[model samples]
Every structure is written in structure tokens, then in C-alpha cells.
Target chain A: MNASDVVTVASSVLLVLGSLLTLIAAIGVTRFPDLLARMHAATKPQVLGLVLMMTGLALSLGDSQLGWKLTLVVLFQLITAPVSAHMVGRAGYRTGKVRSDLLVVDELTEDLRAAREETDREQAGR
Target chain B: MRVSGSRKWLEKIPMVLWLTVLWVLFWGDLSLANVLAGALIGLFVMTVMPMPRIGFEGRVSFIGTAILLGKFAVDVLLASVQVARQALRFGHDPHGAVIRVPLRSHSDLYLTLTAVLCSLVPGSIIVEAHRLSGTLYVHVLDVPAAGGIAKAKADVLAQERRVLYALATDADIAEAGLPPRPWKRGRTDGPDPTTAVGPSGPAGDDQAVTR
Candidate 1:
């Protein structure tokens, strides 16, 4: 009924929702067919879940100082998550971890093929 | 020479301020001593480890940034649910596609930001980014769910447009072959919606695959 009570209830709801999202992300990572798809599960929902969990924590703590630190955590996650995901996806592709069978259309292969041919032609000319 | 040195020093101010802010935030206290200490630490760190300067010539638009951030949040929420549903649905095989989308902007800043934003959204992930050509090879989680290849490419371009609006200059926007600022436009007829999503223009730059 009171303001603090309402804040507590909201934070509790956010905590549960955030946990559920993170759990779904875990399931997606396990169930997705390939590395790239798994990257999606590992990165996307996890980001929103982290943001939600951080917001809930900050709200529950009721300290402006802690809130700023929590904001930094979310900011750092937002900045770094994509970089890590990109690196993993690139590495997976290079290592042939991506399943071509699962992909409906692939354009990168053609581009890579053309690039390699151009280099080969240059080497032949030399 | 002196002017250039001073300008360089001026350029370092923002970095210093940002580092100092981070330092203070880490300590979770705002006092005169903390501020001074943070600044000193910031200056020390920058001097010790210099980073390559990223070029930024765009003017920031508050409204555009608001739209970008607001839509980004919503996209994350909705797409998360979509991906979650895809994962939960039993026996459903999601067919992904690696579609190359040639972005309009040539700048690395916009390219990186667009890549980062696209990666956060569930369905599309940037598998490879060709810096020279400014093309992003995105892997879509579900081709049909994403409304086909053209739709996915357009989504990436749309993300770039929102990014350009937020930070890119009007000249850069025009250079990218996009219409001028929407707020400043007088004409209702923008570039044909078809061309906006159309296959590679007259340039013939995007020639990888067409279906």
C-alpha cells in the first residue's frame, strides 16, 4: 500500500522477469542448431535480462551511489557484449563451425570466393 | 605548431572527463578529493595507454538519439521474446541466412555502431563487416520469420539510417544517397521506397547473391 511496499513489489517482479529472460537465453543457447544462432541466444536476451536485473538491483538497494555503479555495469555490458558476440561469430565462421545446411542463403561465401580469385589472378600476373 | 598542440590537448579533455567520471562512479562517492583524484588517475591512464582516435564529424541530434535509443530498447525486448519463442517451439527448424547488406555510410563509427546495435537485436547478427566496401554480412535467425532476405537487408539499412540521423551530419547523409533530414525536408516524395530497399543501385557494388 505504501510507496516503499510498491517499490519492493515492482523490484520483485523485475527480478523474476529478468531471471526468466536469462533462463530463456540459456535454453536458446543450448537448443539453437549452430554457433551463430547460439550467439544470438547468448547475446540478445541476456543483454535485456542484465539490464533488467541491474535496474531491479538498483531500485531495491535504494542508494543513489549504488545506482550509479549499477548504471556503469549496464553501460559496460552494452558496450562489450556486441564486441564479444561479433568476435565469436567471426571466429566460428572462420573455423567452419557454422552449419551451412541450416542456412537458407549464404552470400558471404560468394564474396570470399571472389576475393580469393582476385588475389589468385594478381599472383598469376606477378 | 603551438596551436596544433593546444588543439590536441583540447581533444584529450573529453577523454579525461569521461575517465574521471568513470573513476568517481566506481568509488560511488562525489567529493572534491574524489574528483581531483579521478582526474589525476584519468590523465595518468591516458598518458600511459594512448588509443587510436576514432573520427567523429557528425553533429548529435537529441530527438534522433531519443528515437534511436527508444527503438533500440523496444527492439531488444520484442526480438528477445521472438527468439525465446523460437527456442521454446519444439521441432521447429529455423532456417538462417547470411545476407550481405551494403550500408550507405562509409565511416567506421557508424558502421561499428550499426554492427553493435544489430548484434544486440536477436534475429540479426553481424557475421562479418567488410570495412573497405562498408558491407555487413548479417546472419538472420529465421529467414521467413524475418520476412525474407530483402526485408532483413532493409532492416539493417534502416538501423543505419537511424544511426546517421542521431550522429551523422546532413552532408554525410546526402553523401550516403539518403534524403536530407526528415525535419528539414519540404518535399513529401523521398527516394522511392523501392530503391530504398531495392537491390544494389547503378553502382553495382553489391554483387554477391540475388534471389
Candidate 2:
């Protein structure tokens, strides 16, 4: 297939796959109980879906400039995604909203408990 | 150069070149002025881009954000009519239950957007979103007899995440995937996760959820 045709076909396939993954992820976000669990479902498919769709579009349109813009679009995506997820995770934890059973280890809870105890002792001394 | 991510300036190289090439393509000439202007604009954007860094990563993509807005508009329009009808028929019910549907998204930005989108849907006016807690306390205008409390909350949570996904940076989602998947999407976590403190931390107040 020509590059355009190839990109068109691949993009179509990628978009289909990406859309499916995204739908599943979104479903999990809603259906899955708890904030952490929902977040787990929310982030996975979004990046993949964007990458697939961008690659597809870059291929479909051979406009060198637009393609590069799309590449920039992709680059920005990589940088921002993880940062956002981390924030949500921390917020969930701080709020005690995380699914405790699923968590293998939590350094945060220990730190909080220790800090609270220290405060209690200080208050008692005062 | 201790930060591994900072060194990946090359990762964005393709995008920059792509932009330069785009500038050339758009101008359709190798004029000195065009080249200089394009280079200047490109470099300026690149320098400014990294200045704002949330501890988590971000992957900016306009295509996706646009896609999401399209979906939100449709949902809002449909929901608005439904909510209007309920209000007209039943009058206002102040007794509507307040729910705290927590989401897994970690950022103040995403949570805020999700809250705003939920409130915009007509039936739900988000009363408060404990940013520190990630819990959205939304007042559902009409509580369904069949669904009860859990169902009402579920409906709102599901819709909220759809909006969140629509707005979140694609990079945020992908990096979150680097870790292995947690098993089973079953069972809601309980209210053991309550008790609010300050809405945001000292440094992060600017980005915390507003709605």
C-alpha cells in the first residue's frame, strides 16, 4: 500500500483498537469501585488511544508541517499524562480514598500515623 | 542532568522540526524572515513549555481535547432537557442527597474539570469536591426510586470519569500504565476514606480543584 493508504488503513485499525481500549478504560472508571481503582482504569487507554490516532492522522495527511505539529501534540501528551495521574493518586491517598486492600504497600499511611502520634505527644506535653 | 526526563529534549525534537517544516510548508518559501520568525516562535514555545511541571507528567494533545469537548456538548444538551423537565414537574426538592463519588485521578486540574462537567449536566450540581480527598459531593436533582443511593452515585461517577478521560493529558494515562495492572475492577471502597482537611497543600493551591 502507498504510504497514505498504509497510514489510512493502519490509523483506521489503530483508532478502532484505541477506541475499544478507551471505552473499556472509561467503563472501568465508572464501574470500578473506589477512586484509585477508577483512576487505574482511566489512564491506561487514553495515552494509547491518542498515540494511535495521532500516528494515523500524521500518516493520512502527508502535509509535512501538520504532521510535525501532530508530533508536537504527541510529545506534550507524554509529558503531561504521568504528572496528572500522580496528582490524582496522591489526592486519593491523602483523602483515604484509595482501595486499601489492593495496595501492596503504603508508606504514606505510616508517615501520617507517625506524624499524628508526634503531634499528640507534643500536645500532651504542652 | 540528574533528571532523566529533562534530558529527553530530543524526544520533543521531532515535534519542533515538524513545526519548522510546517512553518516552511505554510509559507511555501525559504525567505529569511519566515525562517527566522518560525525558529524564534518554535524556540520560545519550547523554552516556556517545561516551566510548569506538576510532579506527575503531562502529554499535551489538542486532538484529544477537541474530541472530548464534542462529546461533552452532546451529553450536556441531552441532560439539560431532562433536568428541566424534572424541575418543572416536581418543583425543587431540597432533600436531595449529597454524594461523595471519589475518582482515582490524582491532579487538581482533572478533578476540577470532572466536577465542572458533572455540574453542567443539569440534574447534578456539584456541592463540593474535596480536592484533598478526591471526593465529589454532588447533589443529584432527582433521585431514582429504582437505583437508590448507590445507583445515583454510580451514575454520576461513571459520567464524571468519562469527562475526566476526555480532558486528561494522554501522557498522564500512559505513564500510569507503566506499573502492572491492579487485579479486578470489582467492589466499591467504603467511607473509611473520609474526614477532610485543607483543600490543597501549600505549594499546590494554584492547581487544586475549584469546583
- Candidate 2 versus truth, CA RMSD in Å, comes to 17.3
Q: Which stretches of candidate 2 lie over 4 Å from their true place?
A: A1-5, B1-35, B38-211
lDDT for each residue of candidate 1 in B1-211, tens digit (9 for 90 to 100)? 1335655565668799999999999989999999999999989988899776774556666667888999998998899888888878778878899999999989998999999999988899999999999999999999888998999999999999999988776678999999876864664455434223222332122321111
- For model 1, the superposed segments whose C-alpha errors exceed 4 Å read B1-3, B186-211
What DockQ does each candidate score versus the true complex, computed on alpha carbons? 0.74, 0.03
Question: Which of the numbered candidates is closest to the native, going by highest lDDT?
Answer: 1
Fraction of true A-B contacts recovered by candidate 1: 0.74
lDDT (0 to 1) per candidate: 0.84, 0.54
Name the best candidate (by TM-score): 1
For candidate 1, what is the TM-score? 0.89
Across A39-111, the per-residue lDDT of candidate 1 in tens digits comes to 8888888888888898899889999999999999998998899899889989988988888888999899778
